[model samples]
Target chain A: MRVLSSNLRLFWQGTLLSYRALFHWLRPAQYVASKVFMPLAQMFFFVFLGTFATSASNAGFYIIGNAIQITAVSGIFGVTMSVGGERETGTLPYLFGTPANRLVTFFGRAFMHILDGMLGVVIAFAWGVILLGLDLSHTDLPALALTIAVTTVSTCGLGLLMGCLSLITVNVMFVNSFVYFLLLIFSGANVPIAELPNWMQAISYALPLTRGIAAARLLVGGAPLADVAPLLWTELGVGLIYGLIGYVLFSWFEFIAKRRGILEVF
Target chain B: MNVRVLFKYWRTILIVAEMTIRQQLMDGFIIFTVLFQPIIIALLALWMLKGKGPDYAIFVVVGSGLTGLWSSLLFISGNSINAERWSGTLEPLVAIPTPFEVIIFGKNLANVIQSLLSMVLGYIVAAFFFGYDLTIVQPWYFAVSLALSVFAFISFGLIIAPVFVMNPGVRAWQNAMEFPVYLLCGFLFPIALLPGWTTPISYLLPPYWAAVSLHGATTVGTAPNEIFFAWGMMVLFSLIDLLVASRLFKLMLYKARADATLGME
Candidate 1:
């Protein structure tokens, strides 16, 4: 009982610390510009150009498609950049040096990333609906939330992996660039995966972005809850597996860097 | 005259350019990432078109070429800005006898030349492997479009360089600009394919005009009047961006020098 209480305290502390750091770093003006306004601008750009040419239904799909695309891209950026930035700022080491349980620290950081992703998605989605007049009736709120949860975790995993791999200062920029284009190509953000070559489709299927995007498309297509089961399961499985892998690798890397005194290289 | 000083500094610019190119090529990871982008994009295009006709190859070739060029320019410019600022080397450049504008111009010229070369090479590879035809309607129009496009993009790069210098942390923001540009500019597909509301925003970007001009030049077999309009807009945008960038750079230098002295105190 005593140990359980201690563990709970550690988790709460880690969570609080992570949240504090995240909010501190996010410049409110830039956050609004990037996560909110830019998406609305993009929606406007696409809507004005293609509305007359395609069916209204198709236009709706395009809006939803771009919305999800913006969400996922912003989500990934939020996770990876935050992780890399925290590492660069020497806060990761400070957190590690604390008496908190490593697992709590790990999960706490991932939870904060998930929260950030949710905030970005919510802002972008709200902007799309209100400012761009995009229809949101196609969304199955519960199912959509589930899919977002899976994607957030999965992306957090990938971000953690990148944070583990990169040197401190350059990590966020390099990882963001590398992953941004890869996700754009595979996730069918601008185009459908069916339109890609067979080999490219195969690669897309292996990526978490593909599953998340597929699930998103179904939700936005007004499909019933059952229709998105396969995607949900795949995304969930991938998210869990990647999340575990990322946690282990990040913790191991942290340990190694600490022992080798390379943590100060930044 | 100060022409001798400019000439002397020009050698340093060349060395910087050469070193940048060598580093880009030798960095196996970055090379692989850069090379993979076009290949993946081409494959995606082939899948989408799916034996309908060979005309889609033209779209893939041009789109991938433009993408490669854009990526090269963005990567070099952003990385150069971030690297010089973080390494503290940019401070000394101000003390040199050469004018700052000349040095800035030299750097921009070097980056443009390197990016153009890489883009051409990538285009060749895509054409050879993917069966892309290299036909052109109006070579002069194409030439003009290319020149204007590079100038406009490099100007955009310059506009953001001060932000990068001030806060190397904002590299993510700089990098983030690529996707919006790629999507809205109609690189892989037509901007007409985007929804009606989004079309107007695409017009604000220089790449959209470049793409339209190129499409007109290649498909319509003449430089349309719109080409002149695009050229005019690009020149106007470049001038505005240069003015803002120059002012911001001056501010950055003043602050940086002040900080350096304070640190010594």
Candidate 2:
């Protein structure tokens, strides 16, 4: 009970710190530009293209897809770059030296970005709902919210995994871009997974957003939670696997860096 | 004296542009931007436009290609100053004898050239992979518009470079600006589809004019006068953007020198 309470406190405190840092450290223009307008613009770009390609209904498909896919960008790039950013700013050594449990510290620091990713999705969805006149009356709001939350968590896990990779990889830019565009392609954000070749489809299944996006489309069509339950379960398991593997990799790398005294080398 | 000085400055800008292009080519990230991202966008468009006629496919192909060009300009040319700062070279680069604007414009030149490669790659993908027949009724007009559009885009980059240099935090805005510009510019579709209010905004931006001229030159039944008007607008916007960029660059240099924050961040 005490341990759980301490972890909870850490989570809240970490979130508060990130929230403060986001606004205080970042200029208002930048925050609004990146966090707000960028996702909306991305959604608009694809939705319009989809609209041109087929019809308004297809545009709605892309609207929901791209809107939810914002989590992949915000959660992944934010966490990964923040990791590289800490190193560049010469603060990683101090961070790793702290006595707190690494896993808790990791999740704690990333908690708000997870929320921020969800915020991006919400904003995009709202834009779609308003601009595209997507009738959400048929949508199960609770189910959609739950699916979004899980998707955020799942993508955040992959982001954390990439963050761990950033610790050892000096080419964070390439890694981040590769991961980002890879997800953008494979996750059916802009194209249907069914259109992809068989091997690519297999690869897509292992990724975070495939099931989430699938479930999202269904949810948007007013499918019940029970129908989408299987997909949500698969997504949850993927997130857990990534989180666990990332934690292990981070611990191993941290141990090696500390032993070699090269924590700040890169 | 004025002509001689201007020639020397032009030489310096060219040198900087050459160096920037070489350096950027060596960057792994550029490969993704140049090759991977554009191809993915084209493929996505192809998939989306599969059942649609070849005309839509060609439009999206060119659109995605131009998206790559615009993205490179936004990230590369726009961030060239920020990149220098991060590398601790901004101060020394600024302290050099050449006017700072010359160096940035040179960098923008290199980025513009690099972005053109996307168009070529986009053409190849559209023609070979997708087997779409591209017909340009006026190749010479298209060539002129393409050349003018490059200058217009470089000028556009110049307008934003100062913002990145002045406030390092605004570097974050680069990503934000990209899609918005792409949407507003209507790189994939006609700007007519955008609501009544946005038309003026699209008209003001250079990319919109570029897109209009490019599309007009390629499509059949386009009026020669319309294409010329687009060319004229691009040139006008480029001139206005350069004027604005000149003033902003001067202010940025003055502030950075005064604050001793040229490369601190």
Candidate 3:
């Protein structure tokens, strides 16, 4: 019980400090611009392009897909930067020096981002309904919310892996932006999954957002939670796998850096 | 920058541009901006527009290329000054005998020239991979439009770089600015699809005119008068942009020196 309480305190502090130490430092104006305004602009561009490709009737498909995909702004970039930032800000040495539980520390970094990413998705959905004529008359509100949460967590899981890769790389933004844009293609955000070529489809399933997007589309089309539960479970499992891989990488990196006495970035 | 100054420092400008190109080619972010991002966007546009028929191949190629140009102009050229400051070179660059605007112009020139490669790559992707028999309907007119568009974009970029450096609040919106221009400028679609109020906004943007003339020249049956009007708008906007950028650079340099912020953020 003492150990459990101690770990909880470490988790909370890590979440808060890392969240605060984010590159932008959480200024409200920059936050809204990067998190709120930028994602909407991206969503609108694809929504319009999708409509132009097919027709206005298909706006919901693009809207829902993109609204869910917008979570990556926080999930990929935000979470990666938070984890990667530990190294960039010279905090990794202190972090590894502490006797704190690595599992709690590793997962704690993504805690706030999961919530932040969910809010981003909510805002995108709100914009969709307000401006783009997205009707939620038949959507199961709870199921849709769950979908948003799960999807965000799943994307943040991928971000964790990206964050680990970022620890070893200097071109983090390049990799982050590439994966973010590539998601717009492979995640069925703009183009339908069925329409993608066989190889693309294979990749689409392997990624996080693809299943979550399809599941959300189903619920929005009036399907029950039971119908999309498999996809949700699969999404959760995929996230767990990625998160576990990220944890392994983080632990291994710490061991190697300490062994080689290259723990601190020069 | 005065036209006379550009002519007088033509050799310096060329050297700066050559060095910038050599230096930035290794930068992953710049390489993505000038190359891969545009190609990926082109691929997405092609697959989305697959049902629209073969003629759209060239249109997607040019539109995605324009997206790259605007993105590079906004992000790369927009932050060019900040980049120098971050690297601790802005002060030396400013202290040099040569005019600061000339160096920035050459940098923007390098950026715009490198960006044109995205168009060529987009064209290749459409022709070879997508198997679209794409051809420019009016080669000579298209060439002229391309030249004017490059001038217009560089001039516009000149205004953007200093303005962003001078206004941190405005720079905060830089991420949100890219797609709206793409939407408003009709980079991927006709502005007629947007609401009526946005037409004037599109007309005010130099890239819209670039798109107008470039798209017009690429497709058949556009009136020569329409194309001429677009070219005229390009020349007009470029002149106005150069005028605005001249004052901006002067004021920026004055403020930076006065406040001792040139070496600061």
Candidate 4:
């Protein structure tokens, strides 16, 4: 009980501190512009293009997919920056010297981002319904919400893996932006997965948001929660695998840093 | 900001442009901004608009190319002065005998010129990968339109660089500003698809005129009068932007020198 209580406290503090440190510098207006307006604008652009390509009736497909994909704003960039920022800001040394549990610290970095990412998706969905005339009358709202949460967490899982790469590279932003945009294509946000070539479809399934997006689409199409269970489960599992790999990488990096005395050398 | 001054320092401008292009090529972020991002956008667009048939290939190529141009202008050229400040060269550069705006013009020239490669890359991708036989219907007209669009974009950038330097709040809104312009400027699709209220806003943007001219130049059936009108609008905007940028540059330099905030963010 005592160990659990202490770990919980550490997790909470680290989660809040890292998130604040990363974004609190931006004024509220700037935050709203970046966090709120930017994703909405992006959603509008794709939704318009999608409708133009086919017809106005197809707007819902893009509205949902992009709204869900917006979580990656928090997942990929936000979470990656939280972890990578330690190295960039020269705090890695102090972090390493501390005797806290590495698991708590590592996973804690993504906790606030998961919640933040969920809110972003929710906002995107709200804008979709309000501005773009997305009809959700038939959707199982709870299932769709579940899909959003699952998708955000899964995307953040990939973010964790990308964050570990930041420890060794100076071009973390480049990597993060590249992966984020690739997800825009590979995850079936803009282009339909079925329309893609066989090899591209294979890559889609390997990605985190693929199942989550498909699941969300089905739920919005009025499918019951049970119908998307397998997809949600697969999405969660894929995220777990990525997160575990990230953990392994994080541990390996820590070990190497200590032995070689290069905790923040790069 | 007088157009004549640019000609006076032509040699210096070219040297600065060459150096800026060389330095920026080595940066991964710049490379992604100017080249890879547009290519990826083109790929996604070609796939998304696949149902629109082959006529839309040149549209995607040109649209995605404008995306690269706008992105390069917003980020790289918009930060030209700030980039100098960051590298601790702003003061020395200002102290030099050459006019400050002249050097920045050269840098913008490099950024805009390098960004054109995004269109070339998009053309290749559309031609070879997507197997679309891309052609410019009026090659000379398209060439002239492209040159005017580059100058207009450079002039527009001159205003943004100083404004962002003077106002960090405005700079913070940079990411949010990107896609709206792409949408408003009718980069990939017609702005008529947008609401009626946005038409006036579209006309207010220089890139909208660029799109009209470029897209008009690509189709064999478009009226030459429409293309010429777009060129007129671009030239008008360029003049207005240059005048506005001149005032902004003067005010920015004064504040930076007076407040001793040149080295500060």
Q: Which 10-residue span in candidate 4 chain B carries the lowest summed lDDT?
A: B245-254
Chain A structural similarity (TM-score) per candidate?
A: 0.82, 0.93, 0.97, 0.98
Give me the displacement of residue A178 in model 1, in angstroms: 2.5
Winning model by TM-score:
4
Candidate 1, residues A1-266: lDDT per residue as tens digits? 98789988877776666555654545565555556655655554444323433444555555655565565444456556545656677676676677767776666656665766666566656766776676668678888777777776776666656655554445355556567557766877545778667998887777666777677778877887798888878876776666677678768877888899877575
In candidate 1 the C-alpha lDDT for residue A186 amounts to 80
Residues A1-266, candidate 4: write the lDDT tens digits.
99899999999999999998988654776777778888999899999999999899999999999999999999999989999999999999898889989999999999999999999999999988988999999999988988999998999999999998988998888889899999999999999999999999999999999999999999889899999999999999999899889989998999999999999787
Give the per-residue Cα lDDT of candidate 3 at A10.
96
Model 2 alpha-carbon drift over 4 Å, by segment:
A1-26, B1-8, B28-31, B91-95, B131-137, B166-172, B254-265
lDDT of 2 by residue, B16-90 (tens): 888988898778787777666887777777877787777666566567767887888888888888888888888
Off by over 4 Å in 3: A23-26, A264-266
Query: Chain B, TM-score, each prediction?
Result: 0.79, 0.92, 0.98, 0.98
lDDT of 1 by residue, B1-265 (tens): 1235446777765665576666566554355335555555555454444353555555555666566556655665656555554556555767876555455555555566555553465456546866666566677988898788777776666666666667645654544565567677887667766668879898877667767766666664444787788788888777777777777767766786877731121
Q: After superposition, how far is residue A47 of candidate 1 from its true place, in Å?
A: 8.1
What is every candidate's alpha-carbon RMSD to the true fold?
A: 5.1, 2.9, 1.3, 1.0
Worst ten-residue run, lDDT, model 3 chain B? B256-265
Better of 2 and 3 by DockQ: 3
Worst 10 residues of 2 chain B by lDDT: B1-10
lDDT score for residue A204 of model 2: 95
Residue A161 displacement (Å), model 1: 3.6
Which one is best on lDDT?
Answer: 4
Better of 2 and 4 by TM-score: 4
lDDT of 4 at B43: 98
**Best candidate, DockQ-wise?**
4
DockQ per candidate: 0.17, 0.63, 0.80, 0.80
